[model samples]
Target chain A: MNGHVYIIGLGPGDQNLLTLEVLSLLPTLTDIVGYGPYVERVEVPNTVRKHGTDNRQELDRAHHALTLAQQGHRVGVVSSGDAGVFAMASAVFEAIDQGDISLKTIQVTVLPGISAMFAAAARLGAPLGHDFCAISLSDNLKPWELILHRLKLAAQADFVIALYNAVSKARPWQLDTAFDLLRKELPTDIPVAFCRAISRKDEHIELTTLKNAKSSMGDMQTLVIIGSRYSRVIQPLSDCNPWFYTPRSITKK
Target chain B: MNGHVYIIGLGPGDQNLLTLEVLSLLPTLTDIVGYGPYVERVEVPNTVRKHGTDNRQELDRAHHALTLAQQGHRVGVVSSGDAGVFAMASAVFEAIDQGDISLKTIQVTVLPGISAMFAAAARLGAPLGHDFCAISLSDNLKPWELILHRLKLAAQADFVIALYNAVSKARPWQLDTAFDLLRKELPTDIPVAFCRAISRKDEHIELTTLKNAKSSMGDMQTLVIIGSRYSRVIQPLSDCNPWFYTPRSITKK
Candidate 1:
């Protein structure tokens, strides 16, 4: 009964991106816990118990993990993309701080993985060369005003933006509102790339203009990459699919 | 004698992050060319010829690689991080565009790799959870004025910024100037993370204020991550290392 927890990033919906380090450690785990969809992707051994639920139930899941680890079980709490990036790592810390569970002596390690930003950037040439930012449109925890303010700032700065959790169940209009806010500051012709289910069987990537992106996007599995003023919509000779490139240069000629 | 060139990204220092799809194709190469420092980290077969050089000779190297590939040899032009993101893929494209090389018929494939921003963010917790931007302070390609303008926009928008190629041999003051511009708009207390040689053996990650970062960072290998206004600097209980977390929430409580 080793009492330690390893937080692993499943890496852009693909199992291959899981490091040899993470893969080697998986067998030692007695329990694997994460968001229901994410948990389904992992291949767990017969000895490992699995626990999963919707994203909102993360705190409870984390608390249960801490309790299980306290009882001398080796646990792995997993998340898609790097666990630290918009995943369960911080919530685990917050839960610890809130005194929901007291496992001060427990060993916790955060393993890195390929984020959606990198995966999306790769799928669409190099839209994240010089300066870029990623924002989530879901306003469940924060106010929409703040998201608007950040979007405005990102657009004005001419930063390639990677929008995550762009659309969700309760927040259907959030992505539309974000698109409208960005359209005001950024040129309507700016390239907006939508990469859905990256590195998965249902993978789909499309490059469109910000003006037309709202009508084309839906749900949580999508990631929207808005190119800066310097980003170009290049037509590669190999593929009919439009590719985006953010030049290293900051200024226009 | 099949003439074809494949530009590949080895991914942030670690050989493991290289896609299995890319790794499986490595054995087919006759020659691999890249910057000396970047190529040294890769583990390829002895049958593959290796050509390495400094950064200044990129154009020359691209021409050399194109020549070898045109001579009916399988050539792989290697780059760290994603090949398209500030690497040699564009140089090869530019060389073809210059009409000096008739590689229009030559097959070219740009493979993706993990970028430094993702590796850095994964190491330092989730500063990129919200909207963020990555800007290079290098004045080699653009004027300082444009760099300042982009920085100002990023600051005003409150996007976490990942600054690449921040300091170099000839341009020492560019980073300082960029820092000064950002300091004016962002609070002095905002957390700034300096990650050097990420995923490499000599990696160093430190958390400090934006005001103090200029003096602490080194040359080209460093990546300066400036957290947005929403980013919080928290000391993770596992290690003394300070982690930065950008909340998904728009409003600060």
Candidate 2:
């Protein structure tokens, strides 16, 4: 019984965004497990045993996947976006590290996938061409102080930022605070784009400013993209949605 | 005679990373064009006419694709990683601007795909989980001063920085200058991860400090991932490669 684990990235909610690497490995997986809503994105064949739970139940799912893998099951833990980008890859490793699970015996390979930042960037244009970073506003795992420190750092850097887990159920005010801190460092006119439920049936993308993002953004599904000083939003034509771009060259003379 | 343009994203180098969204649209394309090296990553069928050229020839290719599309041909413009992130999508828009191409008549759809940053993040773990930015050190398009300003901003913000086009044939020391500026704002001890030819053969990933990165990097194929103030490089027991992670929670004790 050869037990191996493959941590797969399902991409941002669309089956079409799944990489061929992940798709090719689906058939070989004896068990597919992840956050329930994310696992539902993949159309797993009936042959593979599916194990899914809520987001808070990640540790439980990882333990189960590890147990199954140790018992000779070819397990694949799926995550939305890139599995390693605020996803399940780290949890799996942490779980593996917490115990004496001999990773030497079991093969573990992490397959990369499309992330929400890339999905959102495609819809909005190239606001992220220059320096940028992706930060999660959810305070579930980390302290808000640390998050605030990171936000302040991002603002001072004038780096375009892709914000993940921006506004969630329990953490509604997180984005507002982040926006406030960002506005202090960035210009009030800085361009901000919001992409909600990207690559999904009800996907919505809109452009605004950091000052106005609070009223414009609604829930956790939204990914906020804030541009640096160099990034600007341009409306191609009348009645056209504004697109973001970072000028290739800036002239000082 | 419908002239349509499908802007596709080819995942980081390896064909396996190409998304189903890009894959499903491949069969419908009659003309495929993109940056020379990236277009070679995809397998275009014999029926589809392929056009590939250097980065300098990007505007020409976009014009060619648009002209073909206007002539009632379905054209697909491909780019490595996501189409929007320093890829062909901007060139298409630039060509449209220069030539006054009527986008209203042409059914142009910009589809999302994975980016090199996401690929690098996935391979290296969660160094990018918080606020970050991507900067290109290529002086061909942007002036070195603007790049320095942006680097200064990123450093002040303490955002994780993903550097693209860091080193090339002409601009050898641009990365060194950028790194030096970054050191001014950030502590010299900040961890930096260099990922070369990710998701491809001869892939190399190493963790070092900003001060030591200049000698370690290679040509255009490499991606530099600089950790945030809180990020650290940990030597995981299972793998020889250094792993980076930002703690899920940060406590102010």
Candidate 3:
């Protein structure tokens, strides 16, 4: 039995954002595994064994999927947002590198999905239309100092910055500190957007300036988009909220 | 007649990579507009009017889309990857900002699609699993110095870098300069991936160390992914090329 493992992203929130490639592959799996919420997002027949665990269990889930696949199961691993963007695709690769020897040869195919940054950016009116960087604000993976260093340098480079995992109950103070740092480093009042639960029924979008942006506006589901110096905002008279975007062409400094 | 405009992405090259939302939106467009190749990619009914143009006329296309929408047409503007990332979303927003007052109030919706970087990274096994930055090498919009400045800062921050619009016949030497710049700044050898025409019939993925990367391996359709210090290569023995990824956690400095 030549077992195979497929890693796929479930997109931000809406099922509509899932790619046809991933959607087509769902029925061919014999087993599926992921974080509880992401696994719940997919619909498969009962014949396919479902394995869902709590958050912060990436390595464990990856190992489980690989082990199952090695045992002649066609396993599918799911992740939120794009699988390669700060998600489970790496965990599976890391498992292949450091796990049991036999698990290394499992055939793995990764399928891309809509990432949170792009999903939120689309709703916010193309705020990341220019050069950009995505930095996760969660300090669980990296040092806070490094995050600050990147924030400063990214601002200096004038790239539209997308902040993932910006705020959560455990780390309420971090995003606030990030805002304070940007205000001091930026010369102009850049446009800022707090996008929460995008594409979901409870979706909330707030537009503010960097000087007035508050960390309280966000939560774990929030993805913050901060525009560069050249970014601008437009208030169309169509009763909708103001839209923000970074222009493609930048004039001289 | 209230005119509505929608800006959507066609994904990398395959129609299967398109999100369900974008696929569903195509048939509803009364008129569709895009670069010639992208416009041809959409399968629309004969009743739908198609507007195809050359490459460098982003401003003109945006104006035309807005004008069509104002005449009570449901117009769709198609871009190659994610509409918001170095694509037509920002151009449409720019047109609204600088165009006629009537165009500003025209209702427009931007839909996100699978971007080239994520598509290429998925094919290459999660090269962007850690903190990452995307920089465009094209100097048509911004100055060359600004691109170099961001490259230096991004590498200094140890970001997994995704270089878009990496090469073209017009600028043959810029990608080579980027490799040289990274080599000078990096302390050790790093894995670099040259992913060209990802998901197309001519798709090519080449994995090489930073020191061994050559400019000739890419074209305008290529997206170069440079792994950070935390990124690693996994040689899963499945008759496949080496897989690359950046682990989620960064151990202490």
Candidate 4:
């Protein structure tokens, strides 16, 4: 019996962003597995069995998919953004590592998708045009001190920073603390973007400065971008959105 | 007369990776402007004019696209990966910044696509499953010293580093110099992935240790991923590809 697992990224809440490979393969899958929200995002055929779980249950979901694949069923594991970036790819691999040796025979492939950082950057102009880094602000997996350290180093390196999972109901003060930490090394006037629900209906984009940025501006769905020293905003002509871009070359003094 | 410029990413090599928005909007464009290779990659309708330019002439190409838009032509400016990441989006905006005031009235939007870094990462399991940064290795725009400095800092911060424009004919030594610099801060055993022509026919993936990595392993089309300290490789049962992933959490001993 042939069995395989395809870990796919749906791409930042927009159905149109789904890759042709993913769109073509979705109809062939026997089972679709993911977090409730991400699983619902894919419009699979009625014949496919859907297994949805909470966001925190990635391991369990990954194991379930693996079990199905091992049982000779082609399983589709979905993630909202690119699967390799803080998503199900790692969870699936980790599960496979801990599982029985027989599970290693199941073929697994991770299909890339448009991540939130790129989606947010496109909407807000090319603030990430130059060197950039992405660090998740959530401390659920790593300690807060490590996160703060990475933030400071990133600022010192002058990377256009993309912070994922910036604020959640359980961790309200972390983003504020991160801003405070960044303020020490970065200029207060640098542009900070709080992009919520990017590429989705009712999307909101808040263009603020480091000094004026607040934790209330973001939720778990928000992807926050802090511009590098070279990042700038071009004023709007009238009511049009302001264009933000970092020049490709930086003149060295 | 309505005039607009659409800066779009074709995604990493694969036609299937093109977003539905890009596919649907291609037929509506009056002209397509981009590097010769990228321009040829798009399957435009015969009615749409194709203006292909040399790669190093980004500014001139951007100006040309803007000129066509000003002439009431709907223009599509194309890039290979995500437009915002080391691509044409910045050049178009930079051109607009320096051009006539009337140019600001022309509508502009950037459509995101799957970047090579993400595509390569997905193909190589999940090497970028943590905090990461992408730095271009070419010194054509920035100084070699700055590139070396950023590589050192990125290593110090323990980032999963994605090196773009890794090796080119004019600047082959830059990549070798970068690896030597990284050797000072990063351990010798960290896994490095040289992924070439991601998502396309004749794609090649080479997994090696940092100590064993060579400049010859990469070229301009290659996306090199250097895993963080936490990254590990999962051995396959027999003939299947080995899985590489970094755990989401870091245990603070």
Candidate 4 clashing pairs? none
Tell me the TM-score of candidate 2's A chain: 0.94
Instruction: Indicate the TM-score of model 2.
Output: 0.88
Q: What is the lDDT of residue B168 in candidate 4?
A: 97
Residue B161 in model 2: lDDT: 81
Give one digit per residue, the lDDT tens place, for model 1 in A1-253.
Answer: 3378777877887776665556777788999998988887888788898888887876788788888888888889998877766777766655655553345556666666667777777676667765677776767677778778878877776777888888777777778878888888988998988889888899988778987888346557888888887777655454336557676544447
At residue B8, what lDDT does model 4 achieve?
97
- Which digits, one per residue and each the tens of the lDDT, describe model 2 over residues A1-253? 5488788988888788888888889988889998887776677689988887887776678778888888999999998888777777777765655656364345567788788887878777666655567777777777788678777877665667788888777767778888888888888888888889888999998788877878336567888888877777655543446667664545565
Predicted candidate 3 versus true structure: per-residue lDDT over B16-42, tens digit per residue: 999999989898889999899999989
Candidates ranked, most accurate by DockQ first: 3, 4, 2, 1
Q: What DockQ does predicted model 2 obtain? A: 0.48
Query: Per-candidate TM vs. native?
Result: 0.89, 0.88, 0.98, 0.98
> Considering summed lDDT, which 10 consecutive residues are worst modelled in model 1 chain A?
A96-105
Those runs of model 4 whose alpha carbons end farther than 4 Å from true positions after fitting are none
Candidate 4 residue lDDT tens string, B1-253:
5478999999999899888888999999999999999999999779999999998999999999989988999999999999999999999988888888877878888999999999999888898889999998878888777888788889888999999999898988877788887788888898999999998898999999889898899777899999898888998774777777888888886
How well does candidate 1 reproduce the true complex, by DockQ? Answer: 0.45
Better of 2 and 4 by lDDT: 4
Question: In model 3, which runs have C-alpha deviations exceeding 4 angstroms?
Answer: none
